[model samples]
Target: MNKYLTLLLLAAVMISCSKPSDIIEQRTFTVSLDTVQVDSKDEILFLNYFLGVSTLDPSQKFLYNLNVRENILEKINLETLSLDTLIQLEREGPNGIGSPFKIIALENGGFVFSNNYTLRYMDANRQVTKQTTLTREPYITDLLPSGKSLSVQSNGISNDGRYLAGLYETSEMSDKPEGIVWFDLENNTGKLIQTQALDFIRENNLTLELEGQIRGGFSTAVFFEPSQDKILFSPTSRNMLMIYDLAADSLITKKYDSKLTSNEQKPGEAKTITDLNEFDKLREDLLKEVTFGEWELDSKTGYRWRFSKELDRTIGEDSLIFKTVVTAIDENFELLGEAQLPQDFVFPYSFWIRDGMPYVFLNIDDELAFVRLKPNFGND
Candidate 1:
């Protein structure tokens, strides 16, 4: 071989063998919070007193909240932070959706609402176009084990509104989810995917029983990655992630080793709490220990962001200080950086990423507000 050609081939081989860390430079980010207050225009915004089922529109121009108490859909303008409209929904009659608990806004000005058993797809005019009940589907029944059942509240529709993804709980009373169900809304078909990767959640769950009633357990955070056409399953008890590719129909698991905190939580043995105080203490302690938060994907940067919390300290009385860390991972699931947020940072009830930045839901007094975390990624 020619000397120049041989040298070029060797260089190519070296580049191909390079790790993600070698190709992508590690970057640090400083997060600054900007609070935006909502303008309700003299009308009271029913926030449900907590983080309820809400979603930002595809264009990020509007936010929709399902007022479970009033059976109304509250549409707020994101750019203006003003309450734009409130569409009343029927509780009975032909268009009744029956107390929707989950909602998803479609790109084509429609919405999908999920109750306990039925999923109703409604048009922009608030007219029910189609309805599906998981309990009536024979395919879902066969997919579950003898005692397990489908959890409609845990399900979410795809961005294109073509499919729905959810998990199968071990039982109606159990907090542990055992399998994933991918259902096609258009074709009325479904497939159940199970893997040993989810065993950690089943085995490591901290369950406390009192008078035959179970309490104190963790649940997996499910995120639908519309850009990649995948569903990500992140268990709160561990630093592991499972990605289900919709197109390829494959499940892949990735485990992370964190330098900022513990990789996974080690819960004490489950026991019967006889006293209410004992149960409360144990629950608080479990939350104080390291636990993962929500997982968000930044489409602009192709970087996955994961939030985690650990007990920083305890103030006087019942006050607890937490150390929240945000971890950044690449497209290949490689950890690139971890940033510790300020001690005064308020934990978000819910969050979403728009244009590669995170916007967390905040409640200022009785008004709706949002704290946008502007990130500066650099070497410093």
Candidate 2:
């Protein structure tokens, strides 16, 4: 009887170890362009550094980007494709913004940005509405007072526009918990909402470069539900989604069963850098030759991760060209779509979902272009 029980256990384990065949319905999105050309008269030299995009209105017809060039915040209208300089930051003064770091778009068409660790909120007119100093609160384990040393990698505003979420990594490079904070924009109070212990580093087989982990690979993208008091997020490295219930203060992880590999190449082709070892190899080779760009994505659609490689054939002296790859996965983490973007395509693309479909915004040389994904195209 014991032998039979052991056999049954072994069979169950084997079945669990087998690859899952079921996947979300595979679909192809048709790509197109709704071009928006920026005029030189606008004084915006380039759309080279993209901060973020926000609709600011429920209509979703208009999009705005708070872009930066040498510390100036320029608001670009996506609907009209017009540029307006709202604020020119200074080094020291009341309105002095000391080297702006990141921008957070609000629901009401306004935005927030960090200048030297101070959170500043701006109105639609690009005027400073409020400012708050980042502080430490006790909700997460081993909570450290981040002060000005907190490195905010990615941030998002809740759909309700009440909470601002900031994902933090300290510059100290010690083995500590990875945490995110939610600040009540109204009350000027914040709490450390989520944290993951470092013990999982071994369990997940995270590759550590030098003394610390490669944070860019594990940075989490925070997204809020349109109507619910919940947040959905995914780490950059793996095919997993985590939902945080704000009201209950509970977390739920959804790991999709997938057979798809994270390869930009077509099926069965040798991947350039499929896993961590290959990634390390690429890093070593490109240590002095390349710098990665931003990772931008839309809700439900996938994301585009980019990099600029310094070419051996110089356009002049040390000229750089960009390359980007777009990847789309469904809620189940199944590969729904992908595209190896053209070299002429722009950096820091924008994505949004309208009417249950995903759309991407790109700047093609002189014209801004939009690409929308369509459904399945004949099973391959």
Candidate 3:
């Protein structure tokens, strides 16, 4: 009788080990884009179509690429929208354009974007045609932009393509709110824009809610502006849209949180997951957890875990991007929507945007993508 009981236990253990696996689900999104007819003249739609996210300029569009592997700017096309090994600088001296803050196609055949230290542009030959100096006066994290230290976040080119206008990064830690900065880019033979957010604000005089709860949170995807020329930004954690008008030199702060169905979505449409090593590590960790037993999905937390689970899968650090939806808006800064986020997804690391179109780049650590209006946007 004892042997029979032991044999039955062994049979049960073998059956459990060979049990079919439960489905590990991914967040599915039936996303839409206000897609236009891709210009036949453009050959590299999938190749050179990454729109650099600038708060001010869209026509200031230029083509550039990130080495991605090294977490550095690999090639910037200063000229004919091509690639080169040279580092593009935005400012004085031959500084390398590491962080590709923005990039666009220039009419005369070139591209430009901001690195950590400069506003670099390239000409047709893909050479360092221009480099505007950046004021790295007070270099610290959290972007402490004082008066002397020009903080450039976004910029815009004029309709006639004669001038470039946009927000210059600044902080009036001394004065009122340390508003936005405006600068000139056409003859930008210098480093930073010598404009003020107050100048633009007074022109349009658009009022924005400067102080809000949960000040700075993860960009979760991409924060979008109308064009690179408009210094407009949206709140991922809050419910507001910050628009800095270059002509007005003012920030027209619009609150999306105002009675709208605002969903926290991956900011951009889609981005390439660049880091391979990091992704592999995540897979291994997840597999280890899966080996323990069958996990259950809990909606309240959006996680499949046992009471003994201690691994914290922070989105930007561990998982992918956080996606949401911007459904509708009303009068006040009260947002309304069913926010849909990935299980264990926390936030985003970087951001990107497209030129001309209303698309934004939603970049997680390894995952990256663009967010745009559905092709049939407003159709429904």
lDDT, residue 97, candidate 3: 43
Best-to-worst ranking by TM-score: 1, 2, 3
Question: Over the stretch 1-380, how does candidate 3's per-residue lDDT look in tens digits?
Answer: 00110000000012233446734332222323421222213222222223333222233233234443333333423223233343333333444444655555456555565553556676666566666544531222213344434334333333223334333433422122233333344543222224342332211111112233222211111133333455444422333445555555555655333121222221222112234554345334432220111111222222221111113335665563323222322223222221222333222222223331223343323232333432111222
Tens digits of lDDT, candidate 1, 1-380: 00110000000112343566555333344556677788988877777745467877878788888777777778899777799998888877778867776677888898887765888888878788988888877776776788777764456666556777777776533345677777776777777777655544543333456677765444334444322367776767788777888789787888877776788778444344556677677677777878787666675677777778888888997888898777767787766667676676655546777766677777678888776766665433
Give lDDT per model, in order.
0.68, 0.44, 0.33
In candidate 1, stretches whose alpha carbon ends up further than 4 angstroms from where it belongs are 1-25, 151-156, 172-178, 204-229, 246-250, 267-278, 299-301, 378-380
Query: Clashes in model 2: which pairs?
Result: 29-374, 30-374, 302-328
Comparing 2 and 3 on TM-score, the stronger one: 2
The lDDT-based order of candidates, best leading, equals 1, 2, 3
Q: Which candidate should be chosen as best, given TM-score against the real structure?
A: 1
Model 3 ranges with Cα > 4 A deviation = 1-64, 68-102, 136-147, 152-176, 188-237, 243-251, 258-323, 326-375, 378-380
lDDT of 2: 0.44
Report the number of the highest-lDDT candidate.
1
